[model samples]
Target: MSITWYIHRLRAMGPAEIAHRFVEKGKKLAARGRMEGWSRYRTSGPLPVLPGLADNLASAPDRVKQDIVAAGRDVLSGRYSALGADWPLRDPSKPFPPTIWRLDPVTGGLWPGSEAYCFDISYRHERTLGDIKYVWEYNRLQFLQPLAADAALTGNPDAIEAIEAAIDSWYEVNPPFRGICWNSGIELGLRAISLLIVTSLCGSRLSDATVEKIRTILHAHQVWMARYPSRFSSANNHLVAEVAGEFLISLAMPELPLSGRLQAKGRRILTEEANKQILADGVGAEQSPTYGAFTAEFLLLCCFAARAAGQPLAKGIKERLALFSTFIAWLSDAKGRTPGICDDDEGRVITLSRHEPAYAASVSAAIAGYLGTPAKGPRPPEIELRDALLQAPAGGPAPPTGLRTFAEGGYTAVRETRNGRDLHIVVDHAPLGYLSIAAHGHADALSVIVTVDGKPLFVDPGTYLYHSGGEWRDWFRSTRAHNTLTLAGVDQSTMSGAFNWSHKAVASLDGIEDGENWRLVASHDGYRNRFGCLHRRTVASTLHGFSIHDALTGNPDQTTEIVFQLSPACEVEINGQEIRIRSEKRWLATLSFSHPGQIESAAGGPAGTGGWYSPRFGIKLPAPRIVWKGALPPEGLLTNVHLVPE
Candidate 1:
């Protein structure tokens, strides 16, 4: 971030925030001066392992051991993949997993470190830094868990040797607070979790020298997290992750005198944040379902650590966990995939398996297993493995499964099983996320996602990029990228930056009724300020499919383009006002428009243009998009989606 941009962002903050920034700046300078000295690279010390971590690792089922062994071997063999994209993390010609820690494989940008201040790094600028996320993802060292677990399970010499090399290389290169890894609290938090898990899994086998280095690394991580905490607008998931990291470490290392202080602080902050970040109805306040799951995962991991230590969090968390799990069950499809409502970076506290496209189902199952909530279906194998590691009960209550309304979360759904088809539709009338910045929230209000027989048809394209000054970032979060009506060729909410919202659109639930056909009525004022028009959508579920009516009530003569973003599985055939979608050779659905308008179909853009969908972070695939350009009539622009019976 430039000084000019810093000043501009500061101008947006309030007096209290500005004051806090100055105080933190001074504190950072003092800490920077101390950490920059010769003591930073120190690597000689004795660190005690966390309580219960060793036992839990030992008790992992044989099933988990088998998968982990393979993954560990793959990681050692230099087949590194992250965030649903394969990474060229190592120089294959050199020895295994070389010092490529600072390399951003995406753009091939190498970050430098010679006593650099954390705030001085220009990591957010993609043109220069090459997507800091790619760098940070690898550096999180999440891949090490399986490697160490492999060593623990099979006493694999190669696994232990590879683990030692990775740790030693990390210690040699990225000394505490001297590199980009030490900058963000969330990065520090996630990295701390990975380190703790590895230590638990293979602390006994690690070389004494490597163990000493880890001891030094963990102490530095604790100090950094304790000193600098994310606050105000940035305090959403980042705060929870940081505190949870501190809490888990503290729970493990109770021998240290300061460990209790960190433990109490982490526990308190996490408890408070669980309530603040999650709505009463279980939806994450960020308006992103994935973020909700991320927070839930963070909490669950902490709870696991606490349980291992025979200390549990306060009662407030259980209530929220139940609600969060319920929300997941409702949103999840037949295949266990949930709606990609807003921004999702595919962030996970633990990277046990990368094959699952997203972690909501995994999280849902894990939560159910831990809480003894009745699971809806057979637990996923990965979920079973995680439960075994966390020591959750094997079987419990069958989780509730049905469509209902979440009034507080501003959502309603319709589930139908008729005509030999299973259809589910979710109507989003939710806020533009939480906090002043509304970070991670998309400009997609009154958007509807449709799934038939557990397959996405009308989809909400997942977020592909963040902190990039490219058009793709805007496109992924734009109104045009959703299944909704886009008016005036602009987003529903204005963007200040990648994560910041300059102007927000307020959405409300007009009404919801069910008789012969299930209907949802919602409206948003995103364009009312500029165009003096409100976009109200009526979504009715029919036996065949769905009917969407986009009404510009305040002004009927306004022009708008109705967009229905298709899943990557869809192939389109457009003819007149009726458009057909096929999944390979099987006809899926047909969309018929009532308004006389120009029809255009788009697929495969060079860089985040129309007709693209992101299933995971850092990955976008070509998908067809249906665009209808016409005037909003007084009765509203009607489009019906008729399901094609097999």
Candidate 2:
């Protein structure tokens, strides 16, 4: 870690956090000695299997069971896949790769596993881990779910043997409190969930010796999470995942001595953290729709586990879950595609489907099932299977319809049907981010995303890279990268570090007028302190189309540039002052500006400076970006977009 990082941490974190880390480091040092002979340690007794495990397994839809079994057989046959790649495990009879292993997917650099934590390994800088994402994928043990499924379905002895051998190999290679895999509580939490799923499904087939080893490893994970929970500003989604993992382990495996304590602690933390990280508007505190979906899924899993254990969720928790589901459902476009705003790591708590980059429809369907409501759209097979597993009662109330505004979240959605076509538009004028770090927040203040007939026309460029600490990271998060106005070529929010924002732009909704046409007005003071200017945006949505007026107050001499990023699928042609946007040779909309300005189209080039879109983490594609630059007029500027559906 650099001195700058430490300074930022000190400034962002409080004295209590510093003290907590001090103590946590000591505990880790002491635990290192105890972890040496962890494999030889004997459990006090046989672990207690979860109550109603068999019933819950049996409750899964027959189709889901068959799919799980099929996935497991595929894994055994060395045809498994993860992170958009084919990943095959070696034969069980062969020794596993050494535990002290570090390979950079991006740069293909390998290092001893022991050095994973000892040295300051910048996964981004060294290009050693490519994204450090694959490491987490490998450690999450999600691949094991299929194995457990196969073992339970066919009573396949080879499947059971494979699961046992894999678990043992991981344990032997990765000692507790060591290596990159042990560095994250979120990873540990995911592993715990995977372990529980496997054990709950195939525990009957495992030998006593194998069960003991699994229990021992689980205990270590529980202790680690309990000792070093993601606290303070760090307590975001990672905290939720960690506590949920501990809670699930405690609920599913009553065999450990600390299971009761873990259960209570986990429950308390999960409940409190859910309320803390999830806003009252049902949006995640992180302010990213993708992260919000991921968090909601995690909470849903907790609710599922709680229900199975005969523990009902708190009334407030259930309501919050419903709100979360509603928010995502409403934000999703007609095609069930959500805007890739803020930091999207493409993280999932579980893989129930083969759909790449979990679809909004599938997530909404699963949520609808859990909440006992009719799905708003067509349900995919994965969602159907999950709905069955969730045991949702058929036929219930539907979610509220029409234009809704989450004032606290600073999100407004206007949905209308014209000419038998659905038009949905979302306006964001929320705070820059959640906590001090705002780790996942983007600098796209006053940005808007619009979908006509369920297709994205105007879009958010999306986060392309984090932790790479390069121009690309900065460019992706800069003001110019978003569909917003930039003053003097400055970002709306100051980027202090890779994940930290300083001098944040404070934005608020000025007012909203609803009628046959809806109007939303909002402004941000990000430039007020620096350039003595404030950017005010007005969006009016009519049946025919929409108009966006941007005005800057205070500074008239400064340069102003307005950007409108188009979806990668959109093809645009500029004729005089009118810009026509089309997709697949079909005209979607036309944009016109009131004042003459320099217009330019941008795409990624060899210089690495241009327009680009990242559909998922670590993947970028060329996209069209329209820029309008001119002197900041005393009266500001206006741009009108008319949707001309044909």
lDDT of candidate 2 over 517-612, digit per residue (tens): 779899999998888878999998655678899998875577788888887888889988889888777888888898898887777773235678
Alpha-carbon runs more than 4 Å astray in model 2: 29-35, 44-57, 77-96, 99-101, 114-125, 156-158, 353-355, 359-361, 376-388, 392-401, 418-421, 606-608
- What's the TM-score of every candidate structure? 0.94, 0.91
lDDT of 2 at 364: 60
lDDT for predicted candidate 2 compared with the true structure: 0.72
In candidate 2, how many Å is residue 570 off?
Answer: 1.2
For residue 398, give model 1's deviation from the true position in Å: 9.8
- Over all chains combined, what TM-score does candidate 2 have? 0.91
Clash pairs of candidate 1? 374-397, 374-398, 374-399
User: lDDT of candidate 1?
Assistant: 0.77
CA lDDT of every candidate? 0.77, 0.72
**Taking the candidates one at a time, how many backbone clashes does each contain?**
3, 4
